[model samples]
Target: MGLFGILIVASILTYIFRDRLFSRNLETKDDKYNAARKERMEEMDRLLDKINSRGIDSLTPGEKRRLDELSGKK
Candidate 1:
């Protein structure tokens, strides 16, 4: 109706939607994170399968390091 009324409504809407706006960014970040994690897990699984089929010594140095990294080992 008045300038003050419109200002109040806008402020309220901003406050109400603030979390949704911020969480949309977070959701995008989380989706990316989750997809990466899934990919890493799949890689780890494939590596483990290779180890299972061929034994650990069959792995190249890079594969070993990647396995260790995936395992969270040094």
Candidate 2:
């Protein structure tokens, strides 16, 4: 095949495997740490919203535990 044909094939393969190729094994520790922190913050916000809308007593046992964990009390 010509170089142009090879490039086209490679581009198609890259597009086909993009998700598997790009979704794993490339994160640095800082990236992972930031992602984890963001997740925790989002969860905490959700929990706090629930508490505000209802009351602390509305929290299930598991939710309460997760709150403590996110708050570093656990």
Candidate 3:
């Protein structure tokens, strides 16, 4: 194979095995917990912003429940 062809094949192989190659360094439980917490905080911020711009009643029932759930985690 020419250099270009070899490079293309190598790139494809890297893509095919990327997950397996990287899974060994997967996040620990604490990392996952922190990530989930951060996501919840972000969601709560978005909900709070909506409430500020619109009104608390503007939230859907699901959103209100989610906000409560996130808040209770703190």
Candidate 4:
């Protein structure tokens, strides 16, 4: 086939296989994102429990900053 025809066929095949080629990568990224989000939620819960039990004044600097960061997003 001519170069133009070959190029067109190659692009068409790439388009057809795009999902099969990339879906796994997309799912992996989604799983990682969900895991990180869940971890953050668990951390926030732990921090809240600490606050309830001991009050805010008992939080360390890092804990205070993390709480502030999470709270500000809300």
Candidate 5:
């Protein structure tokens, strides 16, 4: 086989596996960010519910800090 033949085979293999490799890398970072965002939102919702059920004074300083952080106030 010539250099050109080897190059062609390599290119074909890369193309065939490209989507799988791309998706695996993409999903790793994408899913992590998505999960983090989702968890933050859920925590915020739970805090809001707690405030509604009780009162603002029901929040600890740490919970208040978290709420403020997520709201972009801190």
Candidate 6:
């Protein structure tokens, strides 16, 4: 094959595999972090419901701690 044909093939392969290559470089910690983030969001939703029903001042210390942690203050 000519140089142009090889370049075209190389370009196509690079394009097709670029995302996979980059994604594989992501740390496994990212998955753990995402799971933790999702869990935190769910917890926040539950806390919000509790606050809506019983008022924010009614939250237990643990719930408040979770809220503070989420807010980056803890």
> Which one is best on TM-score?
2
Give the winner by TM-score: 3 or 4.
Answer: 3
lDDT of 1 by residue, 1-74 (tens): 99999999999999999988666544577889999999999999999999999999999999999999999997
All candidates in order of TM-score, best leading: 2, 1, 5, 3, 4, 6
Q: Could you tell me which residue pairs clash in candidate 4?
A: none
lDDT of 3: 0.90
Q: Quote the positional error of residue 51 for candidate 5 in Å.
A: 0.4
Scored against the true structure, residue 45 in model 5 reaches a CA lDDT of: 98
Candidate 4, after superposition: displacement of residue 59 in Å? 0.3
**Residue-level lDDT for 22 in candidate 3:** 69
Collision count for each candidate, in order: 0, 0, 0, 0, 0, 0
Strongest candidate by lDDT: 2
Q: Per-residue lDDT for 1-74 in model 6, tens only?
A: 99999999999999999987667655588888999999989988888899999999999999999988877797
lDDT of each: 0.93, 0.97, 0.90, 0.89, 0.93, 0.89
Task: Tell me the spans in candidate 5 whose CA falls farther than 4 Å from its real position.
Answer: 1-26
- Model 2, 1-44: lDDT tens per residue? 99999999999999999998888787899999999999999999
lDDT string for model 3 (1-74, tens) is 79999999999998999998767776799999999989878998999999999999999999988888878952
Let me know the TM-score candidate 4 reaches against the reference structure: 0.57
The true-versus-predicted C-alpha distance at residue 1 of model 1, in Å, is: 31
TM-score of model 1 (CA atoms): 0.62
- Model 2 Cα displacement at 59 (Å)? 0.5
Stretches of model 2 off by over 4 angstroms after superposition: 1-25
* Model 3, position 35: C-alpha lDDT score: 93
TM-scores of the candidates are 0.62, 0.65, 0.61, 0.57, 0.61, 0.53
Model 4 lDDT per residue over 1-74, tens place: 89999999989998999888667554677889999889989999999999999999989999999988877853
